[model samples]
Structure formats: C-alpha cells, structure tokens
Target chain A: MDLIVIIDYGMGNLRSVEKALEKASRQVMVSHNQGDVRAADAIVLPGVGAFGDAMVRLKRLGLDAAIKEEVTAGKPFLGICLGLALLFEESDEHGVHEGLGLLPGRVELLPTNLKIPHIGWNRVSVQKESRLFDGVPNGSFFYFVHSYAVVPKIDSDVLCRTEYGCEFASGVERDNIAAVQFHPEKSSSLGLRMLENFVS
Target chain B: MLSKRIIPCLDVRNGRVVKGIRFLDIRDAGDPVEMASAYDHEGADELVFLDITASHERRQTVVELARRCAEELFIPFTIGGGMRDESDIRKVLKAGADKIAINSAALENPGVIGRCSKRFGAQCIVVAIDAKLVQAEPEKKWEAFVHGGRIATGCDAVQWAIEAAGRGAGEILLTSMDTDGTKQGYDIDLTRAVTTAVNVPVIASGGAGNLDHLVEVVKKANADAVLAASIFHYGTYSIAQAKEHMAAAGIPMRLTK
Candidate 1:
C-alpha cells in the first residue's frame, strides 16, 4: 500500500484533504511528526493560517527540514491553500516571513478590485500540462477562499492561472512538488477528480 | 471568467429538510441526501445545509444527514448551526461536511474563527452572519443577529464581516432577517455593503423569489452566489431553470447543453 502522509502541523484543513485522498484510494495518516512524513510514499502539506504562525508550528515539529528532504528525494508532494503560500520564497501577509523556497515565488495579497478573499468558485485555466489535471476539463471551476496568492518567480513552474481582479497563478508544479492556491478538497466533483489524478 | 454558482440551501431541523418563511415550517422537505443528489443532477453548482436543529439531539441528526449527503452527493456542501467548539466543527466535518458555518459561536468567541481556520483551513471555516436592519434616527444600520435570527447582538454587520475575514473566515453566509421569507428580493444594500466590505465570497441568503432576484443580487449586490430555499423546495424553480435565467441576464453561469 502506498501510504500518503498528511502533515498536520496544527494548521491547514487536514480532514478534508485526508478524506479526498482516502477517496482517491491512497492509505493516509495525519501526523505532526517529522519521522512519519519522511517515511511516507507521498506527503501532503495542508495549511490554512497566517504564514508566521504556520512557520512557527512547522519549525516546532522540525518538519520544515524533513519536508524539504522529502521533496529532494522526489516524492509526490502537494500543498493546498496556506501550504501553497508557505512553499514560496516569502510572504507579505502580517510581515515578511521566509517560505520553503521549494518553488521560486513570493506570496502576496490578491488585488483589491476583485474582493479580498476571492471566495467561492473560480475558473482555473491550465498553463502547463501535468498529471494533476489528467481528466479534468478545461475551465473547471474550483473552490477558492484565500486572501493571499503565490506568484512564482519561474513562470514555467506555473501549472494553472485564475483571474480575479487580475490573473494569478492558481497552481504550480516543479518536479514532484505541486501546489494549488484553491482547496481541491472543497471543490466538489471537480476537486475530487483532481485529487484522484494526483494519486494515480 | 468564472461561472456564476447556483446553490440550494436546506434548512435542516431534527435531521430533515424544513421550510420556513423565517423558519415557520416544521414539516420535512425530504431526505437531505436525496434532495442534494437531485440538485447535483439538476446542475446545482454547490449546496449548503443549515442545521436549524437547536438541541443536541437534533445536532447529531444533522451530522448524520451530512454523512449521508456527503457520501452520495458529489458536490461540495457546507454545514451550519450550533457549532460551538473545534471539536464540534471536527465532528461535523468528519461526518462529511466540507465546511463548517459558525454564527452564534463566532460572535461569542472571535477566536473560534481563527482557531478553526488555522486547524481546518480557511476554506472549511464559513462565518454565517444573520443581519437585521435597525431603524436609525437618521439612517438605518445593519445589526448582527444570532439564535437563528431571533436576537440582535448590536454589532455592525459590515464591521463583523470585515473582522470575520481578518480572522480567516473563508466565506460569509449573510442572511437578511427582515427580508428572509418575504421573497421581495435580497436586501441589495445589505448584500452590497458586506460584499464591498470583505474579501471573502458573500452568499446572499433570505429573499429570492424569482430569477430576477438572483440576477439583481449577483449583479448589483456583487454576491458570488445566491441561495434560495422556498422556491426550490416548493418546486417553483429548478436548478437548470434558475441558471438559465441567470445566464440570460448576463450573469456568468455554467450551462449544460
């Protein structure tokens, strides 16, 4: 059985992500322990809070280094919402906090015209091909609820884009590391289909 | 551009769908799971189940309904009502709720929004605001209500929305207490007020009698989605019909050929 470890870290939406992955036929476990993440076949970093707080908890569990190491070993890694923000170079929310730098990017607030949280369903247009969106149709409306978004420094790493007040990277893929600004777990059938694609 | 969403909201009391002109009907609409499936098939963009059940027994029944709905309904569903703590939120989510809507509990403790969002992700935390108009000496003011829109908290509805978003609420479910069952149309001022005040998606609940109401609310109030119950429950409008109406009005919607 290929176990998919969902890093809890006391942040992010763990159950929904776990449920989505479980529905995808992958054995899953929620853990804050670093050892479990390193041993897993794949790792999911799901976060939902401030960048500073998430960084504090990630360091407290010493999972920060362990996660980078897992990605280095070429395991399928997925980050959702705050998890996606934390993988960037840094974020401007609250204060300037350093991110995982796993994908070259900086997290910034969404444009003011389109509203702040960019909540509800938004269409994501694929910018680059990847296994994450295998059978999902183009212009699929995915659930989104965030005040911040990741702007990847390397444009080629971006997998999808969604427009709010302005066009922004909605999903990114760099090697085995893939992250989505929207919550695939909350995206209903379209979201479930995306999760299923990732697991396969 | 993203398609406009068509949401069917179910008022669940004692685990069954109940209709109310301001929560008056105690009769059952149908099995929540079956109703949800029908909506999904009819092209409902999303679904919301408000737990109108006030007591503990009814709360458990709502959870069971959520489990059934989640299993068979492939669409995203949000569950609200009587969620007091993180444990309560967790239990409901575990029972198949994609998101937890906090109202009275949120006003009681703003920390709940931050804590729950931190733990479950902002996407899972929906702060439901029940707003009623207060007759101002000079002008009317929006007041927040709790206990299923029975009591007023004196807090400004617009301010509460900003605060909720700041606290990490992924979405806001705003219902107009005065216009709730009137079917006159949504409180355009109230909906627009909140939509302009916060960054999260504002789901306009309460008055929605016809397709024009949905169109007006989405265009003028800037609501991302419009939630209706009575019209949907009484078979006055189907999901397809509603979307077609919205689409014709120049509102963005996902229409099936």
Candidate 2:
C-alpha cells in the first residue's frame, strides 16, 4: 500500500485528483505540508491556474525546494496542467517568470490563431513511450483547458504531443518525473486508466 | 482534432434534479449525483447541473452537489446557477466542480467576469448567456435575457458574448431563448454569430429536440459543444445515439465505441 500525496499548493480543484486517485484504490491525501511530501511513497503535483501565481505559492509554501528534492530523489512525480508547465525553466505567461527548472525548455502561449484557452477534448499523439499514458491509445482524446503550451528544449523529454494550432508538448517525462498539460482526472475512463498506472 | 462536446444540462431546484425525468434503470432520478453518474456511463461527454434554486440559503446545496459529483463522477461536470460573487464561484470550484457557469450575476455586473477569471483561471469560469431574438430587421439582433429569459437586458447578445470573452470568460454557454423550448433546432444565426464572434469556445444550448437537431447545431452552426435538457432527460435519445449521429454528420465527437 503506497501513500500518494497530491500537493495542495492552494490552486484549482484538487478533490478531483484526490478522488480519481482514491478511485484507483490507493491511499491518497491532499497536503501542502513538506513533511507529507517526504512521508509519501509518491507525490502528485496537480494544479490549474496562472504560471506566475502557482510558482509564487509553491515557493511561499517552501514546497518548491521540497518538490525539487523529491523529484531529484527519483520519486514517482506526476504534474498536471500548471504542474506540467511549472516543470519548465521559464514561462512567457503574464511575464517572463522562472519555473522549477526540473525539465528543459520554456512555456509559450498557444498560437493566437486558434482559441486562446484551447478548451476542449483534443487528441494526444504519444511521441515517446512512457508510463504516464500506459493503456491510453496512441491518438486518444483527452480534455484540455489552458492558454499556454510547453516547449521542451530536448526532444527525449517529450512524452506526448497534441495539435491545436500547432504541435506542442502535451506531456513530458524524464526518469521518475512525468507530467501532462491535460486533466486526466476529468478526462473520463482512459484518464482514470492513466492515473491507475501511476499508482501501480 | 478536438471533439465537439455533448453536454446534458440538468435543471436542479433545492439540490434535487427538477423537471420531468423518466429514466428507466436509474433508482433515484431526482438525485443529481445518480443522474450524473448514469449520464457518464451512457457516454455523455460532460454534465451541467444548473441550480435553479431561487433561495439564497439553498444555494449551499449546489456546493454539496459539486462535492458529491466530484466523489462519484469520473468525467468533467459544470455547476451553474445563482453564483453571484467571487466567493460563491470559489466555493463551487473548490468543492471540485470542473467549471462554474455564471448567468444573471455576470450580466448584472459584467466586471465580475474579469475579477473571477483573474482569481480562478479563465478555464474554470464560464459565462452563460440566455439570448432571445427581439429584433429581426435588416440585420438580425438578439438581446441578452436574464431571470430564466423573463427579462431582457437591452444588451446585444453577440456583443455581450464578445465582451464576456474579452473579460476572460473561458467559455460562453449561449442558450437561445427563441428556439429553447420550440424543439425545432438551435438558433443557427444566433449560435453562429456568438461562436464566430468569441475567441473562446462557445457551447450552444437551447432547442435540442431530436438527433438531427443535435447534428444541425454542430454541423451548420459550428458550436464547439451542444447542451440539451429535454432531449436527454426524457430518454428521447441516449448520449451514444446523439454522439454517433453528430459524428456521422461529419462532426468530430468523443466517440469511444
């Protein structure tokens, strides 16, 4: 029995992620305390909000260093939405704000030609094999709601690619680190399947 | 390709699903969580529980509804109705609702759209516009209606939608009062107008009578999503049937089967 800690950085809905993980039949709790992150077998960073605000909160709670430390220790780290974007070195949202620098690249706003938010169920084309999207099909439709997309400097870090106005990294992975721009908890059964894989 | 979403809108009063619902296997049809889970099982892309509860105290029940739905429902769901302030919206979202739709409150003080969107990301804030065609002169003009379409704001619906989006509304839930109960079809002109004008996704609601009507709105009007009440509530058509029909009509849908 593994304890999964869904870091609550005071942003967006976390009950869904907690519920989804609980549905996977695992011990999971939402916490912002660094001790809980240290105690858990695995940590899940799920967020939906602005890049700069998320970073500010993460740093304020002192969970930023705690998160970086855990990820460096090779814990099964899963980032969702803003959690994914925050892994990049920097983001161009609002202004140039530095990120966790956990993964290479910078976050850029989605091309203005298309809808700014890119809100809908879009297809994710898995670029490299990763545990994040284990049973999910190659071109499965996952729910998306965001204005910015992540651009990894290294291609190997890219886990999946989705096309809206252009092909962008929707999911990325390096070692025990994995994150996705889409919300798997709200994306129906296939999404639950992905979360189940994470716990296993 | 992004699949156009098919949402089933449930009008709720006093925390119970209102209106005539006649689903066969559902034990407690009045219970919104059961109804929502049933819809999820039937392949409904997303669910909307519009709280039509008139009283302010009972509004807390909607937050309870969001909590229950969050526990049971695996897919996305939106909670609309009576969210007047930023605190109300935050309460609902914090309760685990994927999105919250603000209607009359947003119309009263359009500034709430910008304030709420800024606090909670735009993705979670949806502005629901109930529009009715009051003028049909040389150029068609639709006015925004409030209080269940009983009152008109004199505000142009199309322009309101544009302003709502500009004010940071992630999605616009446009319901045409003209074709709402008519069951003929969605207001193609009105829906198309808003969908074209807004940079964000426009969910076309109202007039969803039959399977073809569902296809008609998405295909002709280019609605990013379609929300229906009677057509789905009364068991006229299953979500599978509706999605398949729309998909067959050359519309991209979340068709797993």
Candidate 3:
C-alpha cells in the first residue's frame, strides 16, 4: 500500500485531508515526525491559517527541512489551500513571510473588488495536461476559500486557473509536486478523483 | 465568475438526521452520513449540518458524525449549533468540518467571531444570524434572535451582519424566523437588507418551497448562496434540479453531470 504522510504542524484541518485520502483508496497518516515524512511514498501539506503562522509552526517542528528534502528527492507532494501558498517563495498575507521556496511564486491577496475570502465553488480551467487531473474534467468546479493567491513567476507552472474578479492560478504542477488553491477534500467527487490520481 | 451556491442543510439530533429525507437509493433516511453522501452525489454546492441536539454529549456525537460525513462526502460542509468558544470551534474543525457556524454564542459575545476568525482564518468562521421582522409603527425592521429564535437580541439584523463582517467573519448565514417553516418564500427584503450591508457572502436561509423561491433569493436578494432544509430533506427537489433552475434563470451555477 502506498503510504501518504500528511504533514501536521498544528495548523488547519488535517483530519479532512486524511479522510479524503483514505476515501481515495490510499493509506494515509498525519505526522509531524521527520522520519514518518521521509518514509512516506507521497507527502501532503494541508494548511488553513496565516502563512506566517504556518511557516513558524513548520519551522518550530523542524518539518520544513524534512518537506524540502522529501520534495527535492522527487517524491510526490501535494499542497492544499494555504499549503499551496506556502510552497511559493514568499507571502504577504499579514506581513512579508518567507515560504518553502519549492516553486517560483509569491502569495498576495486577491483583488479588492473580489470577495476578500473568495469563499465558494468556482470552475477551474485546465491550463495543461498533467497527471494531477488525469480523469477530472476541464471545467470541473472546485471549492475555494482563501484571501491570498500564489502568482507564479513562471506561467507554465500553472496547471489550472479559476476566475473570481481576476483570473488566478488555482492549481499548479511542477514535476512531482502538485498543489491547488481550492480544497479538493471539500470539492466533491471530481476532487476525490484528483486525489486518487495523485496517489496512483 | 463566482457561481451562486445551493446548500442542503441537515439538522442532526442525537447523531442522526432528524428530518427524514426521502430519496430513492437511501436505505436509512435518518443517517446523516448517508444523507450527506446522497447530497454530495447529487452535486450539492455545499452542505450545512446544524446540530439541533446541542447537549454536551450530543456535541461529541455531532463531531463523530462530522468525521463520518467528511470521510464520505467531498463537498464543503459547515457545522453549526452548540459552538460555545474557540475551543469548540477548534474541536469541530479538527473533526473534519470545513467551517463552524456560531449563533447564540456570537450574540452573547460578539468578540468570538473576531477571535475565531483571527485564529482560524475568516473562512472557517461563519456567523449564523436568525432574524425576525419587528412590527414597528412606521417601518418594520428585522431584529436578531438567539437560542433557536426563542430570545430576541434586539440587535438590528442589518447592523449585526455588517458588524460580523467587519469583525472578520468570512460568511454570514442569515435565516428569517418568520419565513422559516412557512415555505412562503424567503424574505427578500430581509435578505437584501443584510446582503447589501455586508461584504462577506450571505447565505439566505428559510422559507424555500420551490425552485422559484431559490431563484428569488439569489437573484432578487443578491444572496451569494441559498440554504434550504425541508425542501431538500423531503426530496421535493434534488440539488441538481435546483441548480438547473438557477442556471436557467441566468444565475451562474456549477452544474454537475
């Protein structure tokens, strides 16, 4: 069985991600231990808090380096919502907070005209063909709840884009690393299919 | 464009769905997990599980139920009722609920919204306001209520919504007590009043009898989402049908195949 270790840094709702992965037919465990992270076939960093707080928690538990090592070694990694933002170079949520720097991007708040949180289901427009969205339809709707979004320096890293007031990168795929601004665990079946594809 | 959402609310009591849902494939209508799965399959944009059984023991039951539902259903679900403080909100969110809705507790201490939103991001905190129209001499105004509409808070509904949003609540669940259970249709005046006052997404609840009622709330009142219980619970119309109706009405909706 492929074990997917969900990084727990005392932030966000990890159980929902674990349950989603379990339902996706993958062996899942939530752990902050570096050893457990290193042993996993895939790693998922799911977060739902301020970028600075999440970074502080990740560093405090020493899981930040573990995640960097695991992802650098070509293990499949997935980030959800705030987790997706953390994969970028930096974020300006509360202040200028440094991120894991796995991808070339910076997280910033959405346009003021759009709802601050952007909380609802929005259609994702697939930008490229990738393993992450193997079976999911091009315009499948996904659940989104965030105020800040990652603006990748390299446009090709964007796998899917969704529109609120302005078009933004909703999902990104760079080699073995995949992340989505939307919460797949809260996005119904098409979301589960995305997780299943990641596990497969 | 952000599509308007249709949420099916399940009132759970004693870990079981209280209102019997009528669906063809559902073997147990009283099971919240089963019913939630059904709603997810039907492409409900979201689900709200309100714990009518607000006892301390039953709160844990609701948590377990939330866990089960989270495992089975993929759509976003909100858990409301019995949420007292930040700890209670944490417990529910940790139990796999995407968001926690606070009603009476919020009225008792409005700062809870700011605290929870600050700690857990505004997206995870929803302020559910139960409002009823007050008969005044010149003009009628909606007043916020508490404890399942048993106690009047005397707070103006519109002002409370604006205050909640300003305090960092991500969304507002506004239910009109007068229109509740009547199925006459949502109080468009009340919904519009709150939606116009708050920048956060407003979920118009109560008095949804037909697809047109849902349409009226979203289009006429500018509700970001429409939440209904008996209409969906009794299977008068499936979520798909409601979405189709909204789509036909030119309200943007995420229609699933």
Candidate 4:
C-alpha cells in the first residue's frame, strides 16, 4: 500500500484532497507533522489560499524544510493549485513573497484582461510525454480557479500549457516533482487518473 | 479564453436530492450522491448542491452527503443553504465542498461574506441572490429576497450584487423568483443587471425550460455560468445536449467527446 502524506499548512480544504487521493486507491494521511511527512511514500502539497500566507504557515510549522528533504530524497512530490505556485522562486500576489524555490519559476497574476480569478474548466494541452499524464488525453478539460500562475524561468520544466487569455504553464515537472495549476481533485475522472499515476 | 459553464443544481433536503430526478440508470433518484455522479458523467461543468433543510441535524446530513459526493464525483461542487457564519462555511468545505454559497445568511449578516472570503479565499465564497421583480411607479426593478424567497429585502438586486462583489464574494448566483418555476426563461434583464454590476462571475439560475433558455442567458445576459434544476432534473435536456447547443450557438463551452 502506498502511504501518501498530504502536507497541511493550515490553508484551504485539505480533506477534499485526502478524499480524492483515497478514491484513487491510495492510503492518504493529511499531516502537518514533519515525522509523518518523512515516513510517507509520497508527498502531496495541496493549497487553496494566498501564496504568502501559505508560505508563512509552511515556514512556521517547519514543514517547508521537511518537504525539501523529502523531495531531495527522490520521493514523488505533487503540488496542486497554489501549492504549484509555492514551488516557484517567488510570487507577487500581494507583495513580493519568497517560495520554496524547488522549481525555477515565479508566480504572477494571470493577466489584466482575463478574469481576475480564472475560474472554470479549461482545456490543457500536454506538451511533453510524462508519467503524470500517462493515460490522460491531450486537450482534456481540467478544473482551474486562481488569480496567479507560475512563470517558469526554464522552458524545459513546462509539461503542459493551458490558454486562458494567453498560453500559461498549467502543469510543470522536474524529476520526481510534479505540479499543476488546476485542481485535479475537482477535475473529474481524468483528474483521478492523474492522481493514480502519481501514486504508481 | 474561459468558456461558459453549464452547472446542474441539486436541491438536497434531509440529505436526499429532492424533486424528480429521472435518470434511466438511477434506481434511487432521491440519492444526492447518485444524482451528482450522474450529472458529472453528463458533462456538467460544475454542480451546486443547495441544502434547503436548515436544521442542525439536516445540515450535518448535507455535509455527509457532500463528503460522499466529493469522494465519488470528480468535478467541482458548491454547497449552499444553512451556511450561517465562517464556522458553517468551514464545516462544509471540510466535508469536501469546493465552494460555499450563502444566500439568506448573507442577507442577515453581510460581514459573513467578507469573513469567509478572507479566510477561505474569495474564489470559494459564492453569494447567491434570489431576486424578485419589483414594479414601482416610474420604473420597474428587482429587489433581493431571502429565506427561500419568502422575505423580500428592500435592497436593489443590482446594487446588492455590487456590494457583495465589493465585499470579496468571488461569484454571484442570481435567481429570478418570479420566473423560478415558470419554465418560461431566465430574466435576462435581471441577470444582465447583476452581471454588469459585478466584475465577478455571475451564475444565472431559475426559469430554464429548454436548451435555448440556457443559451439565451449566456448569450444575451452574459452570464458566466447557467444553473438549472427542473429542466435537468426531469430530463428535459441533458447537460451534454445543452453544452452542444451552446457550443453551436457561438458560446465557448467544454464539450467532452
């Protein structure tokens, strides 16, 4: 049985992510404890609130270092929505907020012309062949709701791109780390398949 | 570009999906989980489960139902009704609802909107406005209603929408009480009034008789999303059919093949 630890930094609804992962047939545990996180087979960093606040909570709880250690150990780590943005170098959500600096990127507002919070299902175009989207088809609709997105400094980190106003990096991958701007838990069966792939 | 959404709303009472939800494969039509799963498979962009039962125990039932639906269904869903304060909102979201829609409670205490939006991101807080047309001497306008359209608030519908959005509400679910069960069509004027009043996405609800009515709300009223109950509950038109019709009518929609 794959024991997946969902790191909780006191932001958003963590239960939904736990339930979704459970539905994917994985044993899920949502914990803020560093020890539980270290013992997990896989780690999922799921978030739904402001980037700065989430990072503050992560640092306060010392879970940020634990996450880095787990990822450094070559464990499969997945980030969802704001969790994806947190993996970047920095964000300008309210002010300049430093992130975990896992991926080479920065988070910025979607665009002025586009909806402030790009809420709804949009089609994601898979750019490269990665295990994250093993069975999921290209151009599949995924649920997305966010005002900011990650602008990867390195082009090679971009795995999938979705067009809202302009094409944006919807999914990114680097070795054992994978993250998506869309909420896979809320994105129907294709989303579950993505989680299942992550578990495998 | 973001596409228009077709949302199927399920009215849950005592944890059971109320009204006649006639699906050929569903043995128990009143089951909220079954109804939600059916709608998800039908390609509903989102689902809104409104818990009409306001009792304490019944609210828990709704929360339990939300948890079950969230586990089974993959699409995003909002749980509304009986949401009094931030604590109530937390309970629902903790139960796996992606968003919480407050109607009467918000009218009673407008601060709850700001508090919930601030605590649980503005993107997850939806303020639902039930509006009834008010024909006054010089000009006929709409007024917001509360308590399941039983009490009328003197606040102007459009103005209230603006206030709600200003208070950090991510979206507004506007329903026309006059045409609620009439099966005529959505009040395009009311929808447009609210949509234009608020920069946030407005989900047009009530008075959806056919596919054209759905198209009309998005095309004419400029609603970001269209939510229907009876039209979809009684199987007059499936969500896929509505999406196909909207897609052909020059409305951007997510069509699952």
lDDT of 3 by residue, A1-200 (tens): 38889998887667677878897754788899999999999899998878999999999888989999989999999999888999999998887999999999899989658677788888999999898888887888888888889999999999999998899999899998999999888888888888888888
lDDT tens readout by residue for model 4, B1-257: 57889888888888877798779898788998887888888888899988878666656776787688777778888988887778878888888888889998888899999988887788889999999989755766999999888898898888999999999999999999988899999999889888877899999998999899998999899999999999888888888899999999999888875
As for candidate 3, its interface RMSD to one decimal place is: 1.2
Q: How is the predicted docking of candidate 4 categorized under the CAPRI scheme?
A: medium
Tell me the lDDT of model 2 at B30: 95
How far does residue B51 in candidate 3 sit from its true spot (Å)? 1.8
Candidate 3 lDDT by residue in tens digits, B186-247? 99999998888888889999999999999999888999999999998887998999999999
Q: On residues A1-200, what C-alpha lDDT tens digit does candidate 2 reach at each position? A: 38999999887778888889998755898999999998898989998878999999999999999999988998889999999999989999999999999998999998758767788898999987777677778899888888899999999999998888788899998899999999899888899999999888
True contacts kept of 3: 0.85
lDDT score, candidate 3, position B224? 93
- Per-model TM-score of chain A alone? 0.97, 0.97, 0.97, 0.97
Model 1 root mean square deviation, Cα atoms = 4.9
**What's the TM-score of every candidate structure?**
0.80, 0.95, 0.95, 0.94
lDDT of model 2, residue B59: 69
Query: What would the TM-score be for candidate 3 when compared with the true structure?
Result: 0.95
What DockQ does each candidate score versus the true complex, computed on alpha carbons? 0.27, 0.75, 0.75, 0.67
Candidate 4 C-alpha RMSD relative to the actual structure? 2.0
| Candidate 4: regions farther than 4 A off | B54-59, B136-139
True contacts kept of 4: 0.72
